[model samples]
Target chain A: MDYGEADRILTLLTREMGRISARAPGARRSQKRFAGRLDRFALVAVRLSGPPHRLTLLEAELEEPFLGLRDRLESSAAAAYVVEVSAALSPEGEAQPRIFGLVLEALAHLAEADGPPSPDLLRAFELKALDAAGLMPALDACAACGGPLAGEGIGFSPAGGGAVCPDHAAADPAASPLSPADVHHLRALARAPLGEPRADVGRAAHRRQASALRTFLDAQLGRRPRSAAFLEQVMET
Target chain B: MAEADPIRRLIHQLSRLPGVGEKTATRLAFHLLRADRAICLDLARALEEVSAQVGLCGRCANLAAIDPCPTCRDERRTDDTICVVERPQDQWALERAPEYRGRFHVLHGALDPLSGIGPEQLQIASLLHRLAPAAVREVILATNPTVEGEATALYLARLLKPLGVKVTRIAQGVALGSEIEYADQGTLSRALAHRHDFG
Candidate 1:
């Protein structure tokens, strides 16, 4: 969530960019000049000194941070989880701007009331994260036959990372099935604008996608994020 | 992230704390190792006890040994006043304030339709059961000020209103050390609504 506070510098690492820390001084503490600027959702402007070779510090700005996420614990938790992933996956002094942008986009969706970071917002984030990590699940062709995908969701392995058509699913009765709906839904969330959606039906559909993504990601990660338990304690009834 | 050693192993475990990282974890682990034997023993005993004895309270689902818990069993506290919260921490926070003298109900969690957590996942059934039997008057929802908290409060408010319980929200405000000058619109509004009479 980035919008108002333009001064605090956050060290962000993307799979693309080497470790990059940008400064938006007074982001959390400053107001008025950057009132409601550094929101927890969308992207914002940040100026940072690149490591070693790049001597001059340059000002960097973003489209926005997911702006509307402060009030809901679900959205907040999902967004926090994304940030945590970003922090963990990327190493020091490596900048991956594409992955950074992906995370920023995810944060923006999380900030919206109808954002993808709902209690079940797990799937979308996971899919996007995996994709950014070049860990995209096999959805297009069958993992077995390499044929085109069929149906709403296809049986797949989290270990393999994509859709396993019904025949392959039948062959491997115990294999994890990737929902086609879920895959496309995550793709949509990755591309959609970071604001409250106008329709409940669309939101509901997205929510379902997020839920499926959660299962898929947890399966892929094998280990859930430690924050998942605490965040669940706060959200689940 | 370094060569393995006893010191490093301890640091690794220490880093598991919610917010701790490599540096802080290293510092704390070393601190514990260097401390008095008795201190270490005390911690070991505490850990063992928590694992062995601590469990959810039967009445409130809070962590306690007793079945009904002291709070639930106390006769002096108003049984009619029920303070509802999402966790034991929230209940503790309310108890820390002297202004509230009512009894409490820990939901254990709020309503999060996502993550497959629904109404059945919570202690709502227990809460609903407690209502008709107890001489409860007001139900104060003390969930966090976050959106999920509000959504939960509102949902419960609707549910309990039909039961004839006076459901209320714990107003949001600038916390004790919060600067009034820097407070936002929503917080200010909440603070004003729940203003206490100092006189």
Candidate 2:
């Protein structure tokens, strides 16, 4: 975020630090210190100083800039959404090599993608991130009861923590209708490797899956990410 | 205290400006009080006049006293080429250089999705409206070389390319008077990647 005049308040997610916000003085105006190394989604190795309460960025070297992501709008928006989600899921000052690797892989895939990425890519990233954070929603069994989730009228409840059978669906008013196909797709996404390509799930199913994950994420984060809405706008346009 | 005293109120307002702390604001307030009355009065009048008269230009989003900004209204500049910039300050910086004589279109800001800044929040619709007449033959994207600025430029390029207009981005490289050895790695890498043959 832009701070007073030439300064910038940077929120960085690292493998060692997890997530930390630091003050970079003269980052906006001066070219010598930061020098385009602080671009969003760019992996940088930074040297920080000062007390633990308030760390100041002294130097930063760009590791993987992922410059290809800036070549198109869809890719850029997707990258932003991924980074926002990763940062939100990560805790402050904790080691999160898994999540850091997941984010780096996702961004690298998007950067090297042939065209605008499919919505499934985002869904896959969401599932993987949730898994990395140990918050993966209950997909195989009912969230309310450890019973099998089968039959029509199955609901996915963010409040109930995942897939809810028809019997427990009435308990949560916020539960949205989830089809068997969507449940299977979510399960497959959760289990699939990050680099593997998946078939398109069609537009309607994509919307349903995106909405389900969005509600689940909102419940986890306590609020929707601003970039999610922007991503929707860009995709629609 | 600020509500009761004009001096305190002035200091409070000045302190809200970027980079100005309460101490600096107080110092400035006392300095203004000790200075000539005409100088202080002139400064106040200038501020009031600017705040009252300066509004965004309808043609290009730059702040201007008139409907169309002076740059947009100038007959000497060509209408076929429009230089797109992120802010009015960027437009002014380009104006300092005498090489380009094209008109300008200001987007006010770039696309920063994380900050909730998207195409709808900017003057993108106005820019597209200006291009609908088919008068502009080329659009020079002069947005900053930052990530957000690059995203904005690329987003505009994607949208403008479908409209059949020639779209181009400003060159990125090392700054003049800067040593190559002292330049940062990212800048040097980009400079090398975008290198051209010398005359």
The model with the greatest DockQ is 2
Clashing pairs in 2: none
**lDDT (10s digit) by residue, model 1, range B1-199:** 6648877877776676654657778778878888998997898799888888877777667777676888888887888888889998888878999888888888878754334345567777778888887489899988866545665775577579999889887766677776788664545655786688796
- Model 2 agreement with the true structure over A1-237: per-residue lDDT tens digits: 677657889999988888988999999778667877888888898999987559899988888888778777888899999999898999888878999999999999998988887788888899899889999999999999977788887888998889989888777888888888899989998898875777777899898888888899889989999888878877888
- TM accuracy, model 1: 0.52
Best by lDDT: 2
Q: Model 1: what is its DockQ?
A: 0.06
RMSD to truth, every model: 9.5, 2.2
TM-score of the first chain in candidate 2 relative to the native first chain: 0.94
For model 1, what is the error of residue B94's alpha carbon versus the real structure, in angstroms, after optimal superposition? Answer: 4.2
Output DockQ, candidate 2.
0.61
Location of the lowest summed lDDT over 10 successive residues in candidate 2 chain A: A28-37
